[model samples]
Target chain A: MVLSQKLHEAFKGTVERITSHRTVSAFKEKGVLSVTEFIIAGDNLVSKCPTWSWESGEPSKRKPYLPAEKQFLITRNVPCLRRAASVEEEYEAAGGEVLLDNEDNDGWLATHGKPRETKEDEEDNLPSMDSLEIGKKNSIQSIPSYFGGEEDEDIPDMAEYEEPDNLIETDPATLQSTYLVAHEPDDDNILRTRTYDVSITYDKYYQTPRVWLTGYDESRMLLRPELVLEDVSQDHARKTVTIEDHPHLPGKHASVHPCRHGAVMKKIIDVLMSRGVEPEVDKYLFLFLKFVASVIPTIEYDYTMDFDLGSSSR
Target chain B: MADASEKKPILQFAPFQSVVDEGFWHRLSSLKLNKLGIDDSPVPISGFYAPCSHAQVSNHLTLLSESLPTEASEQAACTSSVSLGNRNKCSVPGTIYNTNTLEGYHALDKQSLLKAEAKKIWDDIHSGKALEDSAALSRFLIISFADLKKWNFYYWFAFPALVLEPAATLVGIKPASQWLSPEEAEYLSAACREWRNSNLTADVPFFLVSIASDSSATIRHLKDWEACKGNGHKLLFGFYDPCHLPHNPGWPLRNYLTLIFIKWNIRRIHFLCYRENRGFADMGLSLVGEALISVPEVWKDLNSVPNAVGWEYNMGKKGSKCVNLAKAMDPTKLAIAAA
Candidate 1:
């Protein structure tokens, strides 16, 4: 009868139907597959979905409702809204979660943190790392005033998430120094191709003081800085892409990496819980699997330090 | 009458000092370029440099930065400062014209065969020649940023994908596509941990994304992507990868991905590539709800568009040579059964 139990059962069914690999239930004995969800008012975000994106979390939670760049559906039906990049933190500072601005005959299309209106201001459409899109149209200038933005009318359920505000805190130099700009132009001069390169390296000695040594904690340290870049030199840009290490997603020295001991495993475990999986089982599975997989190795790890968090034995 | 001021010539930093060369500054400062200028250039950041001597403008001074990528360190080697030269007019390399497909995508450094080296390293790794100490191994690689760039060494680091299929499956997620292979599934599951730790979102598609008209639609599509990308099983995200998607069940997975933006007074396309935004645009947001064609495809069909830079789909019609990139179509929408 409990919602968590229902979610557990539903996730089990979905996994059983779709996956051929081992299930959380099968690995339950190792204690690594626990489920947690965020219940916002009424909707329950069932997160046991094994996807690696921000969308993998329980949507119902009010705090980290998968920011706009990670909304589940671009439609009105699943209204897990987000703020426009520019005004996101401002809204957060105001303690707002859902942007209940969009309106339609369905009363409210969806609350995506922007006052639904005409897309008149060109300033609102500028592309920053944090900015989001109005549609898949990909042309900034071509985007019309909220004139036909109500085009989501075909879907009766889609609460049209009104456009959001653009966050304003930016460094003119940091923007250019990031090396994110275009060199070519279209016939008409609209941005047809853009390339971006951003690198932030860290120190070799990366160790965290928090979560120092909880006997049961499965934490480690990171010892290297990184270089990361993401470029969107699409086919239209007719340019060459130089973002080879596109997904490393490395940050400057000020970031946290667990092995180097940043946040306590328990804290990360808490975030994981909000995503749906129960931490107890997740850790148990990690330790158990580590134990099971270590059978034939020349030397087994001292059961004391669990380095690979993926191992059930950790 | 202000010729005295002109004679003394109090120099002001160029508005887009980061982008403009000495000639550009000279042109702008002398009222040659600013006469045709708009207030659209970028502003300067802190710790900016100005001409120490007007005569030294063209000559670059090699000043080292005390700022390291990490906390300020005593190690001066890590502290970098590039003395940039004036823009050299190297006719965009011929490779620009030759690169027509994904296989031939241009790399910043293309001297060596990266794939071959990656394969050899992988063989050594599999055969236990890889140093077991993971941290030391990683540390060794970190210092060689230029080498990695030169060798196209992503293959060296990405061997984890081949070895760990599940994580690899999540490597290049296509938005709203079918289930991933077990290897890919596990690979992606593993990647999710890194992705989650890094706080990655799908809609924040920097590497490759279709430009949008408004922030609302861009955010909407981004939320759609961010949600799916965090799923350990997601890979190769597709926010209407303007190059691929012919239709749904495979294309832009936002099940309800729709045309939310309308056309405005936007008369021409602008590739606003300064720090603010960078991407493609149609002359007038005119190409809204039409056939899903890739840029390469458009490029191949020179007559496809009446514009100078011929835009075409990556995958062309039957009997067409592979002049553009390669893309797979979803049979569900594009498949034609022989009657």
Candidate 2:
């Protein structure tokens, strides 16, 4: 049978095993409900497997591969709050006054000693028909009528309503013109967090998918040639990688020299094809993850697990 | 000088010019005390005023320092300036000072004169003529700004160098420019589009829009966004602000969002704000569920939103206290019901 046919068969069987009711039930029993949980759990399982081992670096060493740093993990995209001040701090800075002491004062009774005029009496005292017509024609003419009319004796001096200059004393600091600085010390460590754009392109010369890394520094600035030296392993940097100006990216990026990736990929493809798997460009990432699981068990490369299974309509 | 060849380039400092009133300085000093409760002595009256200047000279200085080698290669580099191509042509000056005119000595607009002097200092530093003058120049700039009541600008310029001094010593170079270059922006936009297209399904037709400094690019993206409206596909606006200067992203992002929200009447938007070239450093994913007439104090956190499953696993241990868009938009939730 053809290699494709064999790979198709193998892929079908694997998919079946992954989605089986028994496997699902077992996973649930083990308290693993999500794909991420399953993958993480699988990492532990794969690590203990006798067939799996770290293949890179020195063969004489027992565990040559460096342990994964927490910082290197590309888990989630968190919001950069590098310079964001807390809302409370901002409010306080904006001169917001919080009333701590609130004592209800009913001073209206003392201010007006006599009982107020009844609504009925006030209505009766309102301007009559002749005066009302004149008031409508010229609104300004009615102002004097109220000032010197029957209610004139009740009207208090205008000085009583005048607002004091210092009614609510404002701090001089609040009035000061404050200017913003160009940059702040990225105290949140947001600037130091590194992220890389990894691309695998076919190198026709070697007939393999060569990995290229465009590293971004904490500030999201492209890593200069010197900065790229920091992220890569010394051996890889010296022998297998070349730092050059990126054809597309303006800045210099580090590209790993063609290694065993093509041979490994071809071998995996052959194995899958022998099990009846068809050639699929889309399945490359999935296949890569499965193949590398044996060597790099702890690598979190599966993004499909991030999908919401319940919302499969998407 | 004992040896003319070994003589140092004469460094000149701008004369002191106090523009603002002494009373204003006193008020500013007192205001600082009132705000921070740290009583500060009033700034001396005899300091020079430094205006907010452009970064062109610094950028050129950085380029020159990077390209040219000092010591034995200085003569060779100067000769090769002619062959270094058209890029270097504009930078090469006939003379450091215009000897024909009294432009340097008699210029009355102190700000412009000081800016020219600063540029000359940077040029000298890049040329290896004034190697040890950086500390003195920095001090001069700081004192000048402090006296001028422009401590904000002083802190912005001086703080980074102070904090990164140790690292800079090890690296033997100043910190690289923080902002994304135009080329990097283009590459990033293409990369994001490719990623979105590859991952997109019929049910989840994710759209990636790249925003840059150009207004036309933004408008073009908006047009594309409008076309996707009511198509059942979710709109994911990828905002890339090329402004790498400090305190820039907030205002620029706010302005861009304001323009788009008002023009399109977009009730809700899912945005990823990022810097270019930095694959994902300082990148944030947020959802603004309301018609943002003005920029909000805090954008809705991505992890808190429903169907935003990819990022939940990586939530900080303290757990994000950001305003949850999913909860905020739900009508059933009385706490965030629309007013």
Each candidate structure's TM-score, on Cα atoms with residue i matched to residue i, is: 0.18, 0.26
- DockQ for every model, please: 0.01, 0.02
Model 2 earns a TM-score of 0.26
Question: What TM-score describes the B chain of model 2?
Answer: 0.23
How would you encode candidate 1's per-residue C-alpha lDDT over B1-339 as one tens digit per residue?
222222221111111111111111111222212232233121211111111111101111111111112122233232132211111110000001112122332231221222222333334333333222111111100000111111111111110111110100111122211233334333333332232223223112111122222211111222243443333431232221211111111111111111111011111111111010011111111111211111222222213221110111111110111100000111331122101
Off by over 4 Å in 2: A1-191, A233-237, A244-252, A271-282, A285-314, B1-253, B256-285, B289-339
Recovered share of real interface contacts in candidate 1: 0.00
Each candidate's fnat, listed in order, reads 0.00, 0.01
Q: What value does the lDDT take at residue A147 in candidate 2?
A: 17
RMSD of 1: 28.8
lDDT (tens digit, per residue) of candidate 2 on A28-144: 122112233323433432232211111111111111112211001111111122111122233333332222112114455433322232432343344233233422332231211
